[model samples]
Target: MIISCYNEEHTILQVIDEVSAVLPQAHIAVFDNNSTDSSKSLVLGRIQMLANSANIDGGGGTYQSFIESSAPESKNKVPKTQDFAAKINVESKRAESKRLDSASLDSPANDTTLFNATSITPTSINPASIIPTSINSVSTIMPNGGRLSLFSTTTQGKGAVIADAFALLDADIYVMIDGDTQYDTAFLPQALAHFCQNQLDMLNIARATINDSVHRKGHSFGNKLLSTAAAIFFGKNFGDMLSGYRIFSRAFVKSFPAQSKGFEIETELSVFALQQNLRVDEIEAPYKSRPEGSFSKLHTFRDGFRILFMIFQLLFTERPLLVFGFLSVLSFAVSLIIGVDIFMEFLETSRVARFPTLFVCVGLGVIGVVLGVAGMLAHLVVKGSKEARRMAYLNHKKIL
Candidate 1:
């Protein structure tokens, strides 16, 4: 388990405790991006690692840059690697020549293939923020790649970064949530057990219904509106569309090409599956709002627009014709209205209406037909792409 969140000091321990209770065998890992709170201390029994989350040193005199940067490499520069740890690998044949091989004739030992922690991007939390959990030993986290993205005006820190952290972990399942304690940890087992029981590709926990008192007004209401919009647009609905808690099978995570860089990642995840025609399922879970002590880090307008952008993106990506065809129908309706008005005027005195309603109608009708045809062409392309992705995923996971 890789948790990418900040200011999680107060309830992070509880979250960890809940996860550990059910998934005892799992090697839970908390990647600290340098928290300024007691969050590090909250990691109960999990293995702790600190990656290079930077902080400006010396206020006035020395403000230099302090972040490692990286992007997906080109084929020539570096072939695409599905194996996460293979980037730093060295051939065993060379190790034998170096006499690094066990003289006692032991099997080829791992020499160059040690997990160089420097490659994984650090979660950005202030080091001064953590109240340092009492621990005798913890692996030193040396971050590997990519700095926090500064291009986007996002206050929602590291949503995509944390999602990438899970991606790099290269696990059989990927779970996600916000740092604030709004989700019920008690139902975690039910979530995991259901995933395992049916061997599903992905499982989303719908945080739909909650005790009224426990849910906040603004956040709750906004969630309902966006969810309703998403359901109507997609012709499918999950009880809770903005759910921060979900578990995904390895294949889904590996195949998913996440494009959103903020809170919209959640919406993107759900839309991606439906768009790709993946077998996505959901289970009901308790949803509780956070305490006043900690405020929500969501940017209402920015993320709302982002989610809207994602929805349209999926619409374009999935079926361009249907989306555009709906517009075409509206366009044709306007033409029909104008034509009826012209007919009424002609009936009165066998004369045309003062307005050039006939010309306007023809123009609208012609434009609408063109747009509808364009949409149909786009629809064909999107459907073909989705099928290709489905087959690719099945081949990768050996499902077929």
Candidate 2:
């Protein structure tokens, strides 16, 4: 289980506890992006309490080092520049060899190191022992002998955190949920069961709010509009294109090229699945309002435009033929409309008039032809890219 957290101090612990109770067999890793509140300390304290209860050697040392680590230095650090094209080429090379290492991809090479312990003993810790208590009294357990790892990086945004976690944690079945206790964890088991039973590559938990007050009106409207746009552009009706809670098979997680740096990540995820024609499904889950102190990180206007732009970007990249073809048709239509009157006049008079308009019409015609040819060529390239991505996805064994 991978939880992406920021300053979710009021509800992060509760989310951890709820996940622990539901998916005890799953190893929970919380990727904190330099939270300013007590979120980091709270997670570290929980780790320490679990370490003590499990009696795992070196666990205490790991916990202490985590506390003393320089996570503070990362609090104000700017996110690294993401050269997506270069990264995609590198990933393609790695994928060709079918040996993509998540740990090495987009790692905080120069940033301050946070908690990096990966090999802690898996011990059963009681969930009830660590509920809303002081750090010393917290006694959370790692269920089903699964270890709990906390990773802190300077990279900002939920998308960056998730990208880091996907690369850092190795799991057969990965579950990603927000730290903001808005989505009910009770739906986890059902979602997991469906994902595994159907052997899906990705399963999205579409938000079904209990009431209209659960989410902001603007957010709700934006989600619908974005989802509708994605459905039309991608030809997939993903009920909630911006849903944060999702499940992924190893293949999907390892093969995904996470490029979004903010709330647009969800949009990227949905489009990727659609472009690849991966086995995916969605189930409606109850969505609740955030805790009083916990706030939403999403900016309605800013992120909405970002996501909308991402959709068009993906369309141009993944379905270049469709985008260019539409433009080509528009170009041809305009050229014919303008040239029709000019051609009729020339034929009737047997003389050239409005040469500039005729030139414009001819130029548009040529551009239309060029765009059409370009679309076809780009379509071929996109097909090849899709095949390569599919091969990379197939290299990983499915959970079933």
Candidate 3:
């Protein structure tokens, strides 16, 4: 199981504990983006607590070594528990001061932070470079003999962190859930059961809120609009396309080309599954409001527009004929509307009165024809690309 976290301090620990309860035997990896809150300290504390328990149960390793094993490349060892606690206290005070100072600045009503794709370069680190060389290695072992790894991505967006995790983690079945603790972890076993039983490539956990107020009006409307748009474009209805919780088979994960750098990654995921005609399923899961201190990072309008743009992009790339053909028809219709009267006048009078209008109409006609031909040719190229990707998807062994 993989959890993507930012500044979710209020509920991160609870989320971790819930996941641990649900999947005690499974390795739980938490990938953290640079969080200003005490979230990192809280996670580190949990790791220490777990490390202590492991030592008591005859699992041989210290908390310090476990931290080092998670990131073998780092030169500095984490400070011991007491020193770490002191550092966290000092840092928290400084963060509070900074927050107060910035509170006076005008900010968007609901947006915590606007995602800037170009700000952070995509991560280049390979999975092999970070994962423990051997699962059985003493330094890497966790409580109950399952690995609990904590990693921080230098890249900023949720999509970037997830992309990095997809590259770094190797698992037969991958479970992705947000760190906000809004979705119930109770449905995990059932979701996993359904995924494996049907041998699905992707199983989306669609959000079904218990309370209407829990679902923001703007976000709810945006999700419905985007979901409908995706269904129309891709010919598949996954119900809730923006839901953060999902399960994936190794075949799907390994084959997915994750290119989106923001919230629109969900759109890309759905489009990929549709384009490949992969076996997919969806199960309704209870969604709730965030804890009081925790805020949402999603900007309804900004992210909604981004997701909409990504859908059109996928449509153009995957179904060039549909897009270009529609434009071709539209162009021809306009040209005929403008030139009809002029053509009739020329026919009756046997003379040209509006040569410029005629030329403009002719230019539009030519453009229409060119677009029609381009669509046909581009459709062929897209078809070949799809075939190549399908071959790559087939190369991976399917989950039994």
Candidate 4:
């Protein structure tokens, strides 16, 4: 599993814990996209804590439950929404807490119980509850499934982070989830089950229910609008175009050409699958609100327009004949309208009075023909590229 995160210190650990719980056998890697807060430290500490437990237990199966049980109460609580002032106050507290001496943090690594003297909880650590029920209970974690690695980059885009992660890890299957906990991890097993059983190339987790305020509602509507447009253009209806939860097979991942550097990556992913004619499917998952103090990185209007622009771009690139042919037809119709008026005026007056209008009509007609011819040429180029991609994909080994 690959997690892409920003300044999500408030909710990152809980999200990882949940992923670890639901998919015990899955290897998890987190890509921290230049976070300034305690996000990196908290994630690293939790990972260290888990690693310590696994080493002591000899196997991960028995150690995971202990980590879950000992998690702080704040990790489970749904905090009340706070205003900017309250958010700033909370951040200040977080900064102060993160300033703890690194010497002390590393000191517990040698001890049996890492959290015994430290406040490692995300929101507010309760020092009293850190006592060991045995040395085994308070052990630190590093992550023990396949291998755990936390990669940090100074980059600022989700697509770049994911691209880097893909290049770094070699796996049969890849699952991506937003660092902020929005979709429940409990549904992950079912999502993966389909891909494995059906030999599918891509599986997108569609949000069956979005539980948030007006902004979320608007986002849902925008997603539907974009999905509808995509369905029309691509001939495949992706249930949700903006959902961050997705699973991809090795072929799909390796063959994919990722270009978007922002939220539009989701749209690009779906379009790439459609263009490649890959086996793709979707599973319904419940969407929950972001944890309090954790916010979204997407600019709705900006990203929404970007998504729409991507769709149009794919349309022209994939089906240039259809898109530009329509534009050409529309231009031709406008020129015909202007030409008819000019003809009537000249017939009545027995002279050509509107020379500029005649020139404008002629220009429109020429542009219409030029666009139509260009679209045809582009269509041929796109077809050739599609054939090349399809042949390459066929030569690649299938994950299933």
Reference-based lDDT, each prediction: 0.54, 0.71, 0.70, 0.68
* Model 3 regions lying over 4 Å from their true place: 52-65, 69-140
lDDT of 3: 0.70
lDDT of 1 by residue, 94-173 (tens): 22221100001011223222222221211221222211111121322122211111111123445555554544454455
What 10-residue stretch in candidate 1 is worst by lDDT?
98-107
Per-residue lDDT tens digits for candidate 3, residues 310-346, read 9999999999999999999999999999999998998
TM-score of each: 0.65, 0.80, 0.80, 0.74
Number of the predicted model whose lDDT against the real structure is largest? 2
Q: How far off is residue 129 in model 3, in Å?
A: 14
Query: What are the root-mean-square deviations of the candidates from the true structure over C-alphas?
Result: 12.6, 10.6, 11.9, 14.1
Q: Write the per-residue lDDT of candidate 4 for residues 1-400, one digit (tens) a residue.
A: 7888899999888887888777654556678888988988887776565545544544323222123224333422321212000000112333233211101111223223312322232223222232332122222322322334466655578888777666655566788898888877999878878878988888999887764562466687898999999999998898887888999877777677677777888888898889888899988988887778998888778888989998998888888999989999999999999999889988899888889999999999999999999999999999998887777667654656
Error of 4 at 339 (Å): 1.5
* Candidate 2 Cα errors over 4 Å, as ranges: 54-144
Rank the models by lDDT, top first. Answer: 2, 3, 4, 1
